[model samples]
Target: MSGFESNPFADPVDVNPFQDASITQATSGATENVGEFNPFAGTNSGKTIPISAASSQPAVLQTSMEQSAQENAAAGQASLIKQQEELERKAADLERREQELQTGMENNWPPLPSFSPVKPCFYQDFEEDIPEEYHRICKRMYYLWMCIATLFLNVLACLAYFTADSASGVDFGLAILWFVLFTPVSFICWYRPVYKAFRSDSSFSFFFFFFVFFFQVAVYVIQTVGIPRWGNSGWIAAISMIRVNLAVAVVMMVVAGFFTVNAILSVILLKMVHSKYRRTGASFTKAQQEFSSGVLTNRTVQTAATSAASAAAQGAFGRNQEN
Candidate 1:
């Protein structure tokens, strides 16, 4: 029975496949590789790609922003400097223009021939003296004065024709006197004042112009009415003469129409001058100051004052000697 259990399939000596040298060595090697493995380690090439820290990134970004801000400030400063240079150039141009005008004012007005007996008593230049804003109005005033002179001549002619038939030679003589009297006086009184006012922005001249021009407007109204024996061929005088001579009346009516036009223009110009005056910053106080200064600075006034002082000094010396 013992021999039957121990058959030929079973090895006589004890043997195990798991205990072989080659298999044992392979398992030991695999276990050692697993134990030495590390996921965070560098690759086998021995080179690494360095990553920047969060704190270091902020420093680099801040340096770039500071450089951009500096560039913007430099640009702004350059713009301001350019604007200042432009303003200075404009100021220089204005000053040059003012100097040219001052030099031009030395020449005489009317520019009459030197050999002529009549000399220019005033200086006038619209471009040199009058501001650009007041040039048109100043020229209009001059034209108005010329029209007034022409109207006076027309009135004289009408009166001379009226005197040929009517017994009233007085009207013709008075017309001649008015032509001679008012032509020069009106030029000096109102026209010159307004011219000087616009030229120099003189408050005193402005006030004088206003005063004289008011009377001038009143004269225009009276002349338009054509009072009898007043040298004016006004509406009433023209209508009355229609009974005797239609031709003479027609001439007189034309003169009356011209006078009416003059009156209307005078009122309009008065308002215009007042509006200009308001813009000039003129006032009563400034006018008074200018008048006082002008009087004090006058050569005649200074001479008179010197003479009076000398006379008083002599008189006081005489009184002291007598005492």
Candidate 2:
């Protein structure tokens, strides 16, 4: 026991001994410095220390960047969704308009034509057909054009008359006379006759106007040139220089042209008014009256008429059946 206890300096009995103090001191110094003067300390000594937050700076920065990216992605998605919704809304509006237009088209469907080899040249498509109102407008435009042309020519005739000479002198005196005469005649041919024909259906009026106006056009061309013995005194007198009242001739021509135009317009308006009067269904006057009377337009009268017609139709059908 004494021998075992007294071996202090007997080659250290192969026990592990301290090698170098430098490495140990360095490791210990490093640990001590980490505890006391750590590089990641938010507070030191008397101040509050934040260890985890200080160490986690790079990680937090990375996380912050990730969150910011996520927020941007969410905003982009929201914007995309809004755009899609707007597109869908626009599409729905277009669809609604399309459906409404289709309904309107179907409601105004024209009657189907019977199969014929020789089809008449008429409006045959949905949108290609011209309305009667459009035709009337075209007619009005043509009439206005004719009125303007006639007015200008009448002014010219007045000029020619104002500078009076032998009807043979200026080659235009006969033109002036013929235009003045034909102004009234043209009214009888085209405007006045059409007016009367439109006012009250006259079968001959159409035929007469058609033929007369055709002749009037020919006369217009011939009359524009110098007349060869053809005017009031022209038909039965020797060629002589008859000095006409220049101002009076022009005034008379203008007055005659205006009368012709006025006659045409008045007749057309009268016929239009009369025709509109016949279509009781489209009577604005009736509508206005009903509106002023504060009575909602009632279908009672229409229904009564329809019922009477239906009853008559039914009675006729029953009689035929019995027979």
Clash numbers, per candidate = 0, 0
- How far does residue 221 in candidate 2 sit from its true spot (Å)? 3.6
Candidate 1 local lDDT, 1-323, one digit each (tens): 88887768767877788799999999999999999998767665666545656468889999999999999999999998999999878877886797786666655755789998887777778897799999989998887777676457555655755665575566677777777888888889999999999998999999999899899889888877888777777788788788777888788888888888888988888889889999999999999999998788578999999999999999999999999
User: What's model 2's lDDT at 83?
Assistant: 100
Candidate 1: 10-residue stretch with minimal lDDT: 153-162
Model 1's number of clashes is 0
Using lDDT, give the best candidate's number. 1
lDDT of 2 by residue, 1-323 (tens): 98788778778566454556777788889899878875655656457648987889999899999999999999999999999999979977996896686556532212445574444332223124334543453355236335535534544543444345444333345446555666555654665444443333343444454456555544433333324444321211212223345454444444454545545564465455346435524344554553444233236766787899999999999999999
Candidate 1: residue 27 lDDT (0-100)? 93
